[model samples]
Target: MSHRALEVLIVTGPLGAGKTTAVNRLLKAEVAAGRRVAVLINEFGAVSVDGALVDAERPELAGVENLVNGCVCCSLRDDVVATLKAWCDQPEGQRPERVVLETTGLADPTDLVDLEQEPELAGRLRLAGLLTVVSCLGPVDHLRTRPLLRRQVALASLLHLSKGDVDPSAAVAWEGDLRSAFRHIPLVLTRNGVAPTDSPDPWRGDLRPVPEGWEATAGPSFAAARSFTTAWDHPVDPAALEALLLAPPAHGELLRAKGVCAFAGWAARNDGSDRWAFQLADGRLEISPLPLRADGSAPSCAAVVIGTELDAAHWKRALRALEVPPAGARRKVTVRP
Candidate 1:
């Protein structure tokens, strides 16, 4: 008899769509059920915020790795393959039952799925599912302006809506829009942390491998973009940060923006202190104080923007507009696979 390798689940989404939150939910549920798991976070920028969040939530994971400083599709393909192989080689008694990968927002699902077709990794790893989280508030507008978001929605096997509770009545129209985009997949509305299911057995066999030739049409290649990270020892003014993203330069081919930062003055209504989450998309921005941490410690900010052309001068000028003093001198940014 032959031994079977561990099953792997992939969680992906566009920037600011809440893929990390969904993975955390699934990890907690799996842990509670006595299943050991491992997580691999492929971040587009130099800093790893999503990876940090996962470690903070599940400190006991069998393995938690971060592939930062580049997009997974172009630069980290071999790294992902090598990592999965290492996990599979672990002793059977210590090997995890499942593996989860949280891809960068701008990443196309097909890029990661294509790994299975590779001769080296195909037999070692099994595709459990392709779970994608879509922010209900952003998808409708993003699809109109961003080609990446549209491709993300079109390739999902399990579609989850983050912040869906904001407007319950919009479910009907949302469902219709999803159906028009992805008629064959399952779209589940999730709120807080609960998924809407009539029965307890929510896991179904709906996820399948990406069809051939899915990547050629999924927007721009991950190889053509770059990710940069900047840390600030000083807290930023929430209002000022909001204004910068709202009026980012129209020059170049920039496509996506996302990150979290520390605010010194702004405070939540419930608890009066300084902590916030920032997200930008399609000329719109959202700024809200984060409640869990109040003291305004050393906050890090990272951004991943895709452009057809690369201009360091334009990026420098844009970063200057943010007004927060750079913690360390700016370093040369490059992509490594």
Candidate 2:
């Protein structure tokens, strides 16, 4: 029998739209069905909290690869192509049967899949589907003001709605608006992680490009943005760190924040020891304790924050304030691969 290449699944959506939750559910179902899957999580910030969440939730899966510090549509396009190629080159049995890519909220869906159109990475891979998750409770008014949201919807092969528990009337109204706006796409309403269908057709085809003149009116210089990363060696106060993130800079154009934090006076595991992770989206925050390795080494902490025209110094100051021990007491911070 001839060996079949892995199927790639691309999951994307607006900020805080529940993409991670949907991916988690899909992965769990795949595992229960005995399918081998690998995940590539792309983020627009220096710190990557979403990747950590996936690792924590599905540690038993094949493996999770993170492409951080920039949007997949911009800085990491080359990296994405490289990573996918490397995954495909692995030994036949070792390669994953299915691959899932969870894109950053700010990413442009059309730009990401078009990498295949490039001379170098094309033909080696096929796009299985483009799944876009939409939040029923999100800022609909804000989306109306930004063309990117519409572009995201217009490009999706499958449109999944999260927060199915919201008010019936509100959900109906939101669904109606989405149906009208995305008349060509297939829509599915999910509640508590249950998707309406498990068929493959929901996410297959070439993604559609954004409508003309939409980019010009959305914002000035959308392509000029960049994301960078910084890592800390010293422990952090989980509560203080949460507070600092909650109170982001007034003028800062922060698009997203996600990562794990090492805390002082905290054990590395249960019965007095435990590590903590924070996942922030839109305005909601979820905290959970992670199991620690038996080694006595300190837990490394990192985060990825996305924005337009960001200043590293501004972030350094805010992060330093949240550091549990004085910055001078620890080794110099370094970004990860």
Candidate 3:
């Protein structure tokens, strides 16, 4: 860290907590103010779907970039360091005033905040804040207060609750649980990533409540959760696929699921179509329409699944039950510690 001037807001949250949506909203505000802000989005899967999902009224965000195939907490740390270095090296007038780094759902914000301590960015990149999104529609298993989720919630300066409209009672329970677990962190209600109209200044402060005996250098708490990537040969049926996602595998607790699926002719649309980007976090399923990749070609991925104490046999059995399949073998994506 060298004489830092660029402020970075690390937006994070548990799986399906709506981290992407929040970042997009933040970006719109920053851009509206005519401030120079760059958004770096990270995804755990080899194939990235989130970059496109960040789209809003702008169709494509102006200063957004994707860091996929690795979570910044672990494998893609170098990519982050390099990108920031490049930005700082730019002409003073050309550098962005702020950077919004949206970590993968499985990421640990500490891993990123600690980067400010490194010599390279020690004084150059400042931690603006860490914002975490937690939604009411999450899976029953995530409600158990897993260490990974707790760690995410604990490190936030601001907490954004998504899907509160779906279940008011569940939202209250979630807010209560988080309030009981962490102090001083403010919770904001959000829908489709829009920040609450009443939210106070987001950059007010930062909080680090690392539990005793927890080493800052220690790897993220996802050790209990296993993640893998699986692909099929062709497109899938949306209705049938949602059915399987709602009923997860019998083997383990599904914490997150996402994929770029082909729905070439599943339905008719006067408007053109690409693939349907699907994500399951906590247990809520969100599906969106995705355009082609940068090369003008569709993405080459089917799906990615992650869960705690994964039972491979049972997981594969569930995949076999998909309404449309028999296209190819399933390959698991590994997250190196």
Off by over 4 Å in 1: 1-3, 117-122, 139-151, 167-171, 197-203, 212-215, 218-225, 252-255, 265-277, 281-337
Tell me how many residue pairs clash in candidate 3. Answer: 13
Model 2 quality (TM-score): 0.80
In order, candidate lDDTs are: 0.65, 0.70, 0.71
Q: Candidate 3 lDDT, tens digit per residue, 160-257?
A: 88888888888888777767766577887776777668886566656564556545333335555576666656556677778878885666677788
Question: Which of 1 and 3 is the better model by TM-score?
Answer: 3
Off by over 4 Å in 3: 1-4, 55-63, 139-144, 208-211, 215-220, 292-301, 311-337
Residue pair clashes in candidate 1: 75-337
Which has the greatest TM-score?
3
Which of the predicted structures, 1 or 2, would earn the higher lDDT when compared with the native?
A: 2
Candidate 2 lDDT by residue in tens digits, 1-337: 4457567888988767888878888788778878878888987665566765676574457767898767777778888877877777777778677788898877777676665566654665667878988887766665576667776787788888877685566567778888887778878888865676663454365566545664534451236455545565667777777786677666656665666677777756643435577666666666777644445332357765656676767776666556666545755653222
Better candidate by lDDT, 1 or 3? 3
Q: Against the true structure, candidate 2 has what lDDT?
A: 0.70
* Cα error of candidate 3 at position 139, Å: 6.8
TM-score of every candidate: 0.77, 0.80, 0.82
